[model samples]
Target: MKYTARRTWPEKSKSWEYLGESESLEEFALAFATDKALEVDTEFVVIEKAGAESEIEFFKVTRTSPYGLVTAAPRVESEGSSTDNATTKDEQSSNDGGDDNYGGVEAIAGAWRGVISNILMFVKAGGAAFLFFLAAIFLAKWLFNAW
Candidate 1:
């Protein structure tokens, strides 16, 4: 994903200066707010090459989740053709539903990602706790049975 941070100058005529690229959205937002920028505009354009799948990819859901919430994956529009004029929000989500799924594969992928991320964090913390427990047991044995 490419992100450009620009600061606008309001004089007799409005002008914009490109402030280089930002690594993250948080960084871009912070600079826009703190720098007293006149206008902060984000340009979003999705371009697909000659041969690409229009549908979004899905990910498997994690079975053991603390929060029982299914995440949705982001979708890419292969059907919608681009135009010079601005695109409406209504046109974007207006996908002709062929099935009963509330959201397509993208939504499923998102849910799975969330579940996996949580599971990973739990495993990391649990691993550290287990190590500490083993150390305590070893210390206790050494002190009591020092024959």
Candidate 2:
């Protein structure tokens, strides 16, 4: 997939900056992990095979994170083919920028919700038990007074 836009990194965070649009959540993750922020140039000397002209191809290494080599330009998107599907796909993928950090957020939110729900339930149960105790004490006092 090709990334064609720019995103800012969190201020002083461990996350890498995402640039451009990605095809999918997986694609975004791959790009972010492998993107190199600088250009690389290599020089080599070689003899032509039989009398063939020597050909040189340029490659740009964007980033190299845990995933692998994330490349650009060489896989450039085709031209003159913009449509709703393409635009919508871009929107969907870009909207999923949250996918990378889903685990942490989801775990924290799940834990928080569970804790809050349990606390509420405990409080309700405790309140009911206290009310019952008070009622029993009042009943005992009333019976003793009657006696």
Candidate 3:
């Protein structure tokens, strides 16, 4: 299944039609917001080609805990096509620099997540350390005075 991607606004129904299924307006809006927040523009069109299965599958993986959505186009091999050609194309495309923008954005997002995680970890650790130090100091002072 070869699909030509085009940019269009969401209809008044407040839904995005993906693979003939209607997603709720709120979900679509959240998806868009998450994409924008992650520095992804709405200009890219992902063409879902026919692959291993008979039908084209479009998947949007939205992380519930952390706000992020990863949209992937299913890879489909044409009937009677050689596996060698498919493998070669995939390898070539992976090495191609043309799609670097998407990868770059993803990398930036990943970096942001890593930074946030590290900060949170440090904050927790520091808080614990500080509390322990304070407790030890107070206990030593009390023991000294009592003695």
RMSD of each: 23.1, 16.8, 17.0
Estimate the lDDT of model 2. 0.45
Instruction: Tell me the tens digit of each residue's lDDT in model 3 across 103-131.
Output: 56667888899999999999999999999
- For every model shown, what is its TM-score relative to the native structure? 0.30, 0.32, 0.30
Over 22-137, each residue of candidate 1 has an lDDT whose tens digit, in order, gives 55444443443344333222221111222454222222122322211122343333544434211542343454332335457867888999999999999999999999998888
Report, for all candidates in order, the number of backbone clashes: 5, 8, 4
Q: What order do candidates take by TM-score, descending? A: 2, 3, 1
User: Could you give the candidate ranking by lDDT, starting with the highest?
Assistant: 3, 2, 1
Model 1, C-alpha of 17: deviation from truth (Å): 46
Q: For candidate 2, write residues 31-146 as lDDT tens digits.
A: 43445332222111111122344322223333333333233332324554437546864576468654345546666999999999999999999999999998988888897763
Question: Model 2 — TM-score against the truth?
Answer: 0.32
lDDT against the true structure, each candidate:
0.41, 0.45, 0.48
Residue pair clashes in candidate 2: 5-20, 5-21, 6-20, 34-63, 35-62, 35-63, 36-62, 36-63
